[model samples]
Target: QQYLERLKNKQVVRFASQAPAHPLWPEIERVTLEQLQYARLGVEGGVWQLFAEDGEMKMYKREEEVDGLAVDPLKAVHTVKGVTGREMTHYFFSPDVRFEWETTLEQMKVLETIADDTLVILQIHKRVWPASQRDALFWSHVRRVPNDTDRDAQDIWIACNHSTEHHEAPSNEGKMVRVALTVCLVCQTSIEPPADGGPVTRDHLTCKITYCSVVNPGGWVPTSALRAVYKREYPKFLKRFTQYVKDRCDKQPILF
Candidate 1:
């Protein structure tokens, strides 16, 4: 309720018609659309392998490179109890609750609101050992996508974040090492009807989540250090985030 009220009252940010002239606009759009495609298909093509699994959560990663820089693509699938896709996406997209669950986030701010469902964000992450502090500038967008495969199913919700650039917040010029990344969080809700026709409760529902990310540290960092950071951070991040949602949702009324 607090989140819904705040969003209702907050003023939407406007953008110029020539906003496309921004250097990162094209790349942002391209990455966002590409991520949406991957999110829709999920881990279906066998391109993503299950690298780690903890209970209901499974993490996958594919090794790739860009100009000698290590660019690893990651995908994770998990099921959380007692939440809908809308609720999960809302909490993830909302800045109000991000700091609560994102342990590595040192600082975050919204640079601009392109629309009600889209915004440009600037975030500085805590420094890992042997590596400098890192900052990311990205455009985040959230929306509900129709489930064509099952017309009767609820729509899938997605929150996509892609690294971008703006003159006001230049990258790699400051103390923090700039990191380029594209991240997507997709959620699909599943609800089972009670056999006895009792009132539907959280026990009858689950939210399936698909998370994909490709992070490229801007300056030359040792590939070994980068891989180590990812190996530790990715799994921990997912577990913390899901547990955060489960705890919060359990305390409040279901927001379906």
Candidate 2:
């Protein structure tokens, strides 16, 4: 009764139980340390290890469940972590290319794989709220949905989520030109959209492609020149210029 009252506000508590009932329990009372090595390595190579291990863990198959309730493989728990086949926590592995922020212990608990410093890119979807707000049901459903969001949003959100900056852009071309110069949907930071220097339009705007620094490391490019490069380019440079932006720009620019 005292325990129950205390546990009313607590999440979990352990209780004592009788000894093992197995008929073989008395047969092997003492095992050597060598017998324990396999047990230890198995855990290190098992699911949790796979989760902490570098690189990707291959996904052989999956059932499209509602809220990831059934993603973790059952056989893995006992075989890997020495966790008996009971109601153990489930975890899922995602590539470094895409991952998101998740708040709360419950949200973090379902995860069996993701750890800190994992290289993940961000992806946003409109139908749901941030991972912080979702329940187990929503998290399960999350795996089923196709992740297709603006890379820029993904970029900013991931940086913020991890509280770390991604040094490399989508390509080696640097940040600004790395992504196509267009009116940024999230921040409204764009060079081609005409930001205060004389005449600027879609057809007569300078090429917002800054090959060097990520757009004025310390200085902003004039809007006029930003538009001029795209409009007035020699045939030789036109192909090269087009390819540079084409190679780096992620999604097509939103015309304004």
Candidate of highest TM-score: 1
TM-score of each: 0.85, 0.13
Q: lDDT values of the candidates? A: 0.82, 0.21
Clashes of each: 0, 15
lDDT of 1 by residue, 1-256 (tens): 9998776556232222233555556765677667878866756677777778999998888888898889989988899888888888887888889999898899999998776667789999988877788899988877777788899998888888887776679874779888888899999998898999998898988899999988898777788888887888889988988888888888578776
Error of 1 at 225 (Å): 2.0
Name the lDDT value of residue 127 in candidate 2: 17
Q: Determine which window of 10 residues in candidate 2 has minimal summed lDDT.
A: 179-188
TM-score, predicted candidate 2 vs. hidden true structure: 0.13
lDDT of 2: 0.21
**Model 1 error, position 31 (Å):** 4.1
Off by over 4 Å in 2: 12-90, 93-138, 141-256
lDDT of 1: 0.82
lDDT of 2 by residue, 1-256 (tens): 9898888646332321121243322321222122222222333433332211112111111121223222221111111111111101111122221222221112222232122312223222121211111111111100111114543421110111111123322333322211111000010112333356655333332222111101111123333443233223222232332333333332434222
Q: Which residue pairs collide, candidate 1? A: none
